[model samples]
Target chain A: MEPFEGKTISWGEHNGVIELSLHRGPCNEIGSETLEELESFAEVLRTSAGNMHTLIIHSVMPAGFCAGADLRELYRRAYQQPRTSGNSIAEVRNFLVRIHAVFNAIDDAPLVTVAAVHGVAFGGGFELALTADLIVADRTARFAFPELRLGLIPGFGGIPRLKRDLGNGIARDMLFTGRSINATKAQTADLVSQVVAEGEALRVAHALASQVGKFDLNAVRAAKKFIKPVPHAELLREIDIFCELFESPAVAAGLRRFVESNSPLPYLP
Target chain B: MRTLAQTTDEILTLAAQQFKVARETLSPNDDFFKTLGIDSLQALSLLTRLENHFHVELPDYELQDVSDFGTLAGRIQARL
Candidate 1:
């Protein structure tokens, strides 16, 4: 698909399955170039006929899936270096917004899209996995949203989706503490739909793809239409207020008292 | 049709499996978010586990109100 043009990644059909991969050496860093490739690929696949009955987003890297943005880009921006053609934080956020839209499109595509994850999926990479209809992960898959530790939230839809998936309280811990959930825990948490042996993520995903790819494309798309989008405007405000409340003596003392006792959330703690 | 008892059994079984504990330890009558030591993280974790396990999504508010084994079971049964 031309949506991901001039990028090392690829999208093509083989045996009726459309393969989507980040061919940029598996490291698949979400930089300026990668986001452009994703934007192009998503649009083309969204409309093409039978070109994407099964979309597989596999890593080309040996270590893991995507690792989010390049810190070197951040370092460059702080120094005002002309590296990525006006690569400001706003530009990066804009690109990620497009990336989020692209992933959303894939989730709603007529085909079944699966993520073959093995290794670390951090930040946006972790969020990208959330967008997939199915995540076939290996035992080595480590999922984390470490942005909160860096004073950032999931730039993509991770915050909203994870909250939707896991529930608000648990996701807040993930967002606040930035702790990771290992593969076993991921399977328990339903982060990954299936967990196979290490390095066999792609094979299992392809197998699942084969089973699902033959279904009615229209039906698959229809099911997605019925699914609800994340409703986080209120929750996000609550999160902000929660943060603000953390500073209040009322909330702080309330938290301490609640922690001492055993009161539920509607009360405190 | 699955009875409320059956759905409660399934949901509690799934939640127990998720938290890696004995289902007997979590009382159906106990408050989900506080009693049985169900914190918010574990609460969300259990809800996600239930969603993927059952292949049906509960409304966000319904999911939040699943504060006890009985309530969680009721919520799952209602969706069914």
Candidate 2:
């Protein structure tokens, strides 16, 4: 198979298992370029669905799997002058919509997907990892939904996917607390399928991918199809709620404080 | 609005359903994790259900030391 490289993703297929490595900024934040690359990558997968039995999304950068979105970008956009303008609002809305679509495509793909996560997977990063059919994390991996700290919510269908995996009770805890859960705790919660030693996430993910890839493509696809379909309406509802929250004064104030502090958000007891 | 006693009763009922034990078998003094043979994640799940049922967001810090059913019930009751 031909090796494929994009601005943010490098992927190749071997034995029906495709390894897609995310490489972006130091922490692999999902910026606009990364989103565009994912769009193209999804198209490639769509065309090769028949030959691809499994996919593993891992990170090549040592910084982390993904630190979520670019905080700088978020701060810049949130604090930009003329925030009330229709053009600015429309642009932000479209960006979120496009992101949700790509993530949904990944979630709805016929092929089995796995996330090989190590280091920090926060916000959008955590949501992306949750999209996979299975998650394999290293002991060093940490997952959280810190969006609420910034006066935002998980907009990329993270909340609904989390609810599906963990039910509302545990899911809301992660959402409300914005606290990180280690791989061991996540495994106990049944959020992670396997937890390997540090630096072994990719290797374990490859093994799992190979096992899944060994199955007949038809049966694999059929199994995925037979499973319950995601309630897409919920995702739409989440996006709508996120966009509305994004426009609120509270989010603006929160972003201002975050930018000014230039440090972790403090918790007032 | 439910009375404190009513809320406590409801919380116990919810815990019974979640932990899959007879309500009669549990008391307010029983440690939640010990009784359920569960962990923090399970506790978090219970907290989520309580939040949904009560329509309030309980602080995680306030819950860190709550190990028994009575403390958990009291917290929920206070929030309500």
Q: Which predicted model would earn the best lDDT?
A: 2
Q: List model 1 lDDT by residue over A42-130, tens digit each.
A: 77776673545677888867657776655444334433456565434454445555666776676566667789987767777887888
Best by DockQ: 1
**Inter-residue clash pairs, candidate 2:** none
User: Once superposed on the true structure, which residue ranges of model 2 sit more than 4 Å away at CA?
Assistant: A81-86, A264-269, B1-80
Best by TM-score: 2
| lDDT (Cα, 0-100) at A36 in candidate 2 | 90
- Assess each prediction's global lDDT (C-alpha) against the native: 0.64, 0.78
**List of chain A TM-scores, every candidate:** 0.77, 0.92
Q: How accurate is candidate 2 locally (lDDT)?
A: 0.78
DockQ score of each predicted structure, in the order shown:
0.04, 0.03
lDDT value for model 1: 0.64
Q: Each candidate's fnat, in order?
A: 0.03, 0.03
